[model samples]
Target: MSNVSYYTAEGLKKLRDELSQLKDVERPKASQAIADARDKGDLSENAEYDAAKEAQGLLEMRIAKLEETLAGARLIDESQLDTSKVLVHSTVKIKNQVNGMEMTYKLVAQSEADLKTGKISVDSPIGKGLLGKSVGDVAEIQVPNGIMKFDVLEISRD
Candidate 1:
C-alpha cells in the first residue's frame, strides 16, 4: 500500500503538473529518441540504441513512481490549519540555543521539500523535533553529527 502524502493546494498542483509533463512531453521525447537510435541499424552493437533504451526505461520508472505518489496525495486546507503549534505546512521561526542564530523553515511533505527555499520535509530530523512544538518551546534534535538544540520562536500558517 502506498502511504498518503499531505500537500498544500500549490504543492499538489505542482506535483500534478510535473506528472503531466513527464507523460505528455518527456515520454514522447523518449520514444522518439529510441526510434531514431533504432533506425541507425544493428541493435546488437548499437551503443546509441542501448543508451536510448536505458533512458526510456528510467523515464518510465520515474513516470510510474510519480503516478503512484499522485494517487496517494491529499490536499491540506491551509485555512483550517492550527497556528498554535508546529505541524505540516507550518512556517516556523527558530533560534539556535548555542549560537543564537535564527532560521526559519516551512515544514512540507518529503516530495515538496527544498532546502534552498527553506522548506523542510516533516521526516527530517529538525522538522520531526519541531513538530507539535509551540512558541518558546525548546526542541532537542538529533542529527547525524550530534544533538542540536533549537528554540521555537514563532509559528504561522502560510
Candidate 2:
C-alpha cells in the first residue's frame, strides 16, 4: 500500500496545479519534440531523435510519479487542526537545549517542505522527533551532524 500524505488545502491545490501543467502543457510539448525529431532522420543514426525520446521518457516518468503522489494525498482542514500537540501543519516553536537558540518550523508534507519558509517534512529527523510532542516536552532528534535536544515551547496551527 502507498503511504498517505497529509497536506494543507493550499499545498494540495499547488500539487493539482502542477499536475495539470504537466499534463496539458509539458506532455504536449514533449510529444511535439518527439514528432519533430522523428521527421529529421533515421531512427538508429539520429542523435536528436534519441535525445528527444529520452526527454519524453523522463517527462512521462515525472508525470506518473506526480499522479501517484496526488492519488495518495489527503488534504487537512487548517481550521479543524488541533493545536495542543505537534502534528502535520502545526507551527512548532522549540529551543535548542544545548545552545539555547530558539527556532520555529511548520510540519509539512515532503512535497511542500521548504527550508526557506521554515517548513520541514514530517519524515525529516527533527520533524519525526517533534511529532506527537506537546509543550515542555524535550525531543531528542538525530540529525546527520549529531543528536540534538530541543524543548518544545509552543504549538499552533497557522
Candidate 3:
C-alpha cells in the first residue's frame, strides 16, 4: 500500500526536478564508477569493485523509492484550501501557551519541510496537532518531552 503525498505546485516541481537530476546525471555517474572499478583488477579480490557495486545498489534503491513517491504524489490547489482551519500549505500563527512564545509556520509536505524557512511537515507533532484547528482554538500537542499547548492565532493560505 503506497501512501499518497500532497504537494503544492512548486513543491511538486521541485520533486520532479530532483528525480530528473538523479536519472540523468547520477545514474550515469554510478554506471561509470562501476565500469572504472571493473577495469581496475581481478573480480574476486577487488575492493573498489565491491564498493562501487554497493554504491550503485544504494543509488538504485534511492531512485526506486523516489519513483514510488512520485507515482503517488498529488498536486494541491492553493486557492481551493480553506483558510478557516489549519491544513497543508496553510500559514499559521500559533502562540505557545507555556512560555508566551509566538511563532508562525507554513505547513507543507514531508519533502518540502524546512524548519529554517518556517515550513513544517504536516506529519510533525505540532503540525498534526494544529490540523483542523481554527483561530482562537487551543491545541494540546504531545512532544517527546511532554504535552505542550498552543493557541492558534490565525490561519491563512500562502
Candidate 4:
C-alpha cells in the first residue's frame, strides 16, 4: 500500500532538491569511486574496491527511498485548510492545563517535523490528541511521561 502524506510547498521543494542532489551529484561520485578502485587492483582482495561498492549500494538505497517518498507525497493547499479546528498544517496555540504555560505549534508531515521550530508531526501524541479540536477544547495527550492536558486557545492557518 502507498503511504500518502501531505507536504507544504516549501517542504516538497526541499525533498525534491535533496533527491536531485543525490541522483545528479552523489550517484556520479559513487560510480567514479568504484571505477577508480576497480582500476587500482584485483577486485577479489582490494579493500578499497569493496568499500566503494558498499558505498554505491548505500547511495542507491537512499535514492530509491527518496523516490518512494516523493511518489507518495501530496502538496498541501494552505488556503483550503479550516482554521476552526486543529489539523495538518494548522498553527495552534495551546495552554498547558497544569502549568498554565502557552505554546504554539504547527502540525506538519513527518518529514517536515522539527521540534526546534515548533513543527510537530501529525502522528505525534500531542498532535493526534489535538486533531479536530476547536478553540477552547481540551486535549488530553498521552505522552511518554504521562497524560497531559492542553487547552486549545487558538487555531490559525499559516
Highest lDDT among the candidates is held by which one? 1
> What are the per-residue Cα lDDT tens digits for candidate 1 across 78-135?
8888899999999999999999999999999999999999999999999899999999
Count: clashes, candidate 1: 0
What's the TM-score of each model vs. the native? 0.97, 0.96, 0.97, 0.94
Off by over 4 Å in 4: none
Which residue segments of model 2 deviate by more than 4 Å?
none
**Residues 47-146 of candidate 2: C-alpha lDDT, one tens digit per residue:** 9889888998998898898889998999888888678889999999999999999999999999999999999999999999999999999999998889
Tens digits of lDDT, candidate 3, 1-158: 67788998898898889889988999899899889989987979999899989988998898888888888899998888888888889999999988999999999888899999999999999999999999999999999999999999999986
Better of 3 and 4 by lDDT: 4
Tens digit per residue, CA lDDT, model 4, 73-108: 999898988889898999999999999999999999
What lDDT does each candidate get?
0.94, 0.92, 0.92, 0.94
Q: Clashes in model 1: which pairs? A: none
How far is each candidate from the true structure, as Cα RMSD in Å? 0.8, 1.0, 0.9, 1.2
Worst 10 residues of 4 by lDDT: 1-10
